[model samples]
Target chain A: MYDHKTRILYVEDSLADINLFKEFIDDKVELTVVSDGQSAKSYLHRLKQTKSHFPNLIILDINLPEISGFELLNLIKKEQRLKFIPTVMFSSSDNQRDIKDAFSQAANGYVVKPGDLGDYSRAIETFMNYWVYTCKLPQEQ
Target chain B: MLSKVSTFKTVLENLSDGISIIDKEGKHVWINKAMATITGFTKEELLKSSPPHIYWPEEELDTIMKALGETMEGKFRNFELIFVRKSGVRFPVLVNPSPIENDEGEVQYFVATVKDLTEVRRVQHELDDLAYNYRVLHDNTSELICRHELDGRYKSVSPSSIRITGYRPDELIGRDPYEFIKEDHLEQVRQNLHEQALAGNDLIRTQYEAKRKDGTIIWLDTITKTLLDENQKPTELVTISREITELKSLQTKLEENNRELKRSNMELENFAYIASHDLKEPLRTIDNYVQLFEMRYSHVLDDKARQYFEFIKSSAKHSIQLTEDLLNYSRLNSSEFPYKEVDMNEVLENVCSQLQSRIAKSQAKLVYDKNMPSLVGSHILLSRLFINLIANSIKFKSEEKPLIRIAVKETINAWQFSVSDNGVGIPKKSRKEVFEIFRRLRTTDDEKGSGMGLTICKRIVEKHQGEIWIEANEPKGSTFKFTISKHLKESTNV
Candidate 1:
C-alpha cells in the first residue's frame, strides 16, 4: 500500500555511501546518485530542462566541491519551484550548532554519515526507513 | 398666662411648624392655625378634638406628652413624630414643648418648636450614595494598595492584587510574603528584607524571581515602604508588586536582539576589512602596469593617451587608499585597544620623523614645542593620529613654504594640542565633510589625499573619549586642535 517506487536522490560524493544506501534500501526506492555539487546542480538542471519528473526527496551533503551545500541549499530553499523537495543534510560530524542552524532554517532532517561499513549500513537503514514511510513523499509539480 | 391675651395667642398660632397647647387637664384645648393646616384640619375642627381621641394608637400623644411633662419639669428632651393628619395622610413633625404656667406658678400649657423631617430624609439619601461610591473605589483600584498588620500580615488587599497573583484575599492575608518565593531562594529573599528592616531602612522596592502555586516562576518587582506603629517604631511593610515576568522576558529578548545586531554589524565591518585587504594586491598590480605602459609606450602614444593612463593610475590608487582607510576606521570600532600613558613629545617626534620626507619635499618649516604634556591613550594609535595630521598640513600646502606649528597645554582632566598650518585654508562648510571617512571636498589636483586623515584623528580621539575639531587659523590657514582626557582608560567591561 506504501509508495515503494519513490525517487530518492542522494546528493553525496562518497562511493561507499552508494553501496551502503543500496544495502539498506533493498529495492525500496529508485535511488539516484550525484558525486559533486556541480553534478548535483547539473542533475537538477537537467530534470528542469527536459521537463522530467523530479525526485520526491533529496539528501544533500554539507562538504562539496565547486558549489558548497550551504549555497546550494540556500538556492533550493529560495526557489519556489524547488522548495517543496524534502531535504536531509548528510553531515560527516555531529555539530550541535550546525544542527541548530539547520533546524532554525527549516531543514527537513539531518543524518550523520557513519565511519565504518556496519555503522554506515545501520545509518542508511534508519534514514531509508525514516523517509520511506515516516514522511509523506511530495508530488511532482 | 392671662386669659384676656388673645393677640398673644394669635401670634403663637401663626408659626409655620406644628404647634399645640394643653390646658391643666391635659386636654387638647387649643391647636394652632398652622398645626391644623399641617394636620389637614381647620382650627375650628381641632378645637373640638380630644387629646387621646385625636391621635392614632392614642398612646403616642399620651406617651410623648408624658415625656414632655418631664421635659417641662426642667429635663429638656427632643423627639420626632409621624403623625396622621385629619385626612388620614401620614406626615412627619418635630415637636419641642415648653411649659406654660398660671400666675401662681402651677403648670398650665406646653409650647414647642417643630420642624418637618423631609429635608433630613433627603440628606440621608445623599449620604448613602457617598458610601456606595467609596465601596467601588476601594474595590476598583489595582494599586495593590493594602493595609498590613504590624507583624507583616496582609490585612486587606484590593481586587487588583488577586488578578496579579491568582490568590484570593483570604489566602494571602495570613501568609508571609516569603512563602511565595522559591524554596531555594527563599532564605536570600528573607535575609535581604530582614537586613533592610534591621538597618531601619524602608524597603521602598525590590526585585526577585518568585514561584507560583503552579510551580511556574515569575520575576516579582516589589516596592515596600515602611509604616510606623503608634509608638513610632517601624511596624509594617506596604508592598506594591507588579508582575514583571512579561516585562523581564521582553527585556531579555531586546538584549538578545541588540547583541545580534551588534554581531551582525561586526561581521559586516570585518567583511569590509577583508574586501579592502584583498583589493590591495590587484590595485598594486594595476598601478605597476600603468607605469609600465607610460614608460614603455609614451613615445609612441599621444599626450592625451599618456594623460589618460595617469588618470587611471591615480583614480585606482585613490580608491585603493580610501578602502584601506575605511578598513582602519571600521576596525577602530570593532577592535578594543589597551590603554597606556603616552608621552606627547615622543609622539610628535615620531610623527615628525615619519614625515621627514614630506617635510623635506615642501622645505616646510615645522615647529615642535617638545615640552608637551603626557597623555593616557593607546601609544601606537595616538602616534599614527599625530603623523596623519602633520602630514596633511604639509600635503595641503598653498603657494608658500608651509609653516606648521605644534603646541600643547593642560586643561581640566585633559590636554589640548593645536597644529596650525599656513597651508591651503579649509572653508568652514567643508570642514564637517573632511571628518567623514574618505570624503574630499576640494579638487585632487592641489593635493592627493586618502581624505581620511581627519576622520582617523576623530576616531583616535573618540577611542580615548576625547575630541578633535577644526578651527580657522589667523590670516590664511587652518588649525587642527585635539584634546585627550586624562581619564582615557580602557573600559572594564567588554
Candidate 2:
C-alpha cells in the first residue's frame, strides 16, 4: 500500500496552524513545512540545484513575513523547472478577491482554512486524495 | 416748326418716363407713347377724354380736381396721385406740372411729366418689412448678438446687452471686447479671436470668464463667426453669446461631491477588508485551538468542561461568520465585478452543487424550471443569492422534509425570480425586518447563520438596478422574490 510517499511543501508562518495541518497530514506524504516565504525560496533553490528532492505539491499561506503567497506563486510559475509542480493557496481568508487573485496568479487551487478541527481534517483528506493520489505529475529528472 | 415738333416727338417717345401735356382747362392735349403705355390706354382714348376722364377713379376725383385747379393757376407742383388705366387698374404716378406761356406772357397749357412708381413702391415696402423684422429680432432675443470690427471693437450690439452684461447697447458699442473679459483670460480670448479671424467661416466657439457691468464675474459661451464681404474677405466678426455661470458652478459642485463620495467609499472598503482579514484570523485560531484542545484531552474533560469548550468554539466560529458576512455586505456597496452574459440555469446548477452536502443532510427536495433565461449580471453574486436563499430554507425547516422551488417570470424590462420554500414561515411582523442586516428572527443555537444573507441578496439585486422583497408563500412557506434588470450596465460604482 505504500511505495514512496508523495512529497509536499507547506509554506506557513503560524506554528500552531502548521501543527494542526501536521496532525491531519500524518504518514500520508513526505511533508516539508517552512515558516516563512524567504525559507521557502531557499528550499526551492536547493531542490533546483540538487536535481532531486523536488516536491510533487506545494501549499502556500497568503499572509507571511517578507513576501506573500501570490508573489511566491508568481515566481514559481515563471521558473521553467518549478513551474510544473502543482501549487495551491491555503489561507484563513475566504475573500472572493483573494481567491480570484490566487487563480489569476496560476495557483492550481484555493482552499480556505476551516475553524473546526473535524472540518479541517476532512478538507485535508480530500485535498490529499485528489492532488496526491489521483493526479499524475511529470517525472522528476 | 413741324420738323422741330417731329424731332421733339422722337425724343419723348424714347424717354422711359411718361410725358403728357394738359391744357389749362384740365383736358389732355397730347401724350407720348410712354404715357400711353404707362396708363395702359390707347393714345386716341386719352386724347379724346376731358377733365373727368376714363382713367380717373371716382374715389380720387376731389383730390385730383384740387391738384388740377392749383396747376391751372400756374402754381406748379410735383404731386403723387392715383391714376386708373383703361382696364380699371389703378397705380401710383408722380406728376411734374409746369405752366406754358404764350407771347402775351399769359399762362397757356399745363405740360406734365407722369412717372410710374409701381416697382419703386414695391421695393420700398419690401425694404421696410425687412428692416422691421431685423429690428424685432435684434431687440427681443436673449442672446448677446454683437458685430465686432476686425480689431475686436464692438461695431454694433443688440439690445440684449443690457440683460446679459448689465450694459446698454449704446454703452457696449464701439467698446473693445477685451474690456469686459477677465485679465487672466484676456490673452487667451485675444488669441482665440486672432485664430477665429484667420480660420474664416469655421465658426470658432469659446467659453471664458467675463465681468459684467456691475463688476461681477460670469461665464460666457460665445460662438464667433466671420462675416464675409462679396470678395470673401472677412469684414467683421459676429459673436452670439449667453451666460453660463450657473451651469459652470453646478458642474463644479457636482464634481466635488463625487470626489468626496469616492473617498468615503474607498475608506469603507478598506475597513471591511481589514476587518475580514485581521479580525477573523484570531477568531479562527481561537476556534481551531479550542477544538484541538478538546480532541487531545477528551478523557480529562468532564461533561461540564466539554460544554464550556463547546461554548467558546461556537462563539469564535460565530464571530468568524459575522466578520465574513459583514465583509460580503460591504463589498456589494461597490461594484467589483463586471457584468457578463450569464445563464441562469448554469448559475443555479453551480449553487446547488455548492450546497449539495447541506441539501443531503436536510433531505431537501429542490425543484426549478430548466428554461431559465440568460441575462447580463455578475455570475458569482447571482449564485450567492440562490445559495443563501436555499441554505436559509434548510436552516429554518419545519417538522417535515424541506421543499424548495426556484421560479422565474419574464417582465417587460426585467427577469423576476422567486425562491420559495415550505419551511417555518416568517411571521407577518418579522417579514419586513428579515432583509435588514443582523435581523435574525430565530435565536436558536443550532442554526449557524450570520443573519446577513437576505441583506446581501437585497444589495446584490439593487446593484443590478433591481429590487427584492419577501412574501408569504401560500399554504405555509416563505418566498423571496427579486428582479434583475434585463439591460444591466457593467460596473456601476453603487
Candidate 2 lDDT, tens digit per residue, B1-494?
56997998899877888887887777788788988888888999889989897778999999889888888877788999999987888999898998778999888887888899999999999999999998899999878999988888999999998988999989988899899999999888777764666569456778899999999999998888888889998888888988899999998999999999989988977798677768887788888888788778878988998888778877887898898788778877644677888999899999989999999999999999999999999998999889988999888888889999999999999999999999999898888889898878775677868899988888889888899888999898899999999988665453
- Give candidate 2's iRMS in Å, 1 decimal: 1.2
Docking class of 2: medium
Residue pairs in clash, model 1: B96-B112
Candidate 1 local lDDT, B87-144, one digit each (tens):
6766566777777778999767766666667667778789988988877776775555
TM-score of chain A of 1: 0.81
List of chain B TM-scores, one per candidate: 0.60, 0.54
| Candidate of highest DockQ | 2
The deviation in Å at residue A5 for candidate 2 is 6.2
Off by over 4 Å in 1: A1-141, B1-159, B182-188, B203-205, B211-217, B226-234, B333-336, B352-375, B389-434, B466-494
Q: Model 2 TM-score?
A: 0.60
* Model 1 Cα lDDT, one tens digit per residue, A1-141: 665477888877656455546656666678789878888888888988998777777888776787877667777777767787777888753445567666666677887654344565677677666765686755645
Model 2: residues with Cα > 4 Å off, grouped in runs: A1-8, A27-31, A43-57, A70-87, A94-110, A126-136, B1-164, B169-211, B214-216, B220-247, B333-336, B352-371, B393-412, B419-433, B471-479, B490-494
True-vs-predicted CA distance for residue B175, candidate 1, Å: 0.6
User: What TM-score fits each model?
Assistant: 0.50, 0.60
In candidate 1, position B294 carries an lDDT of 62
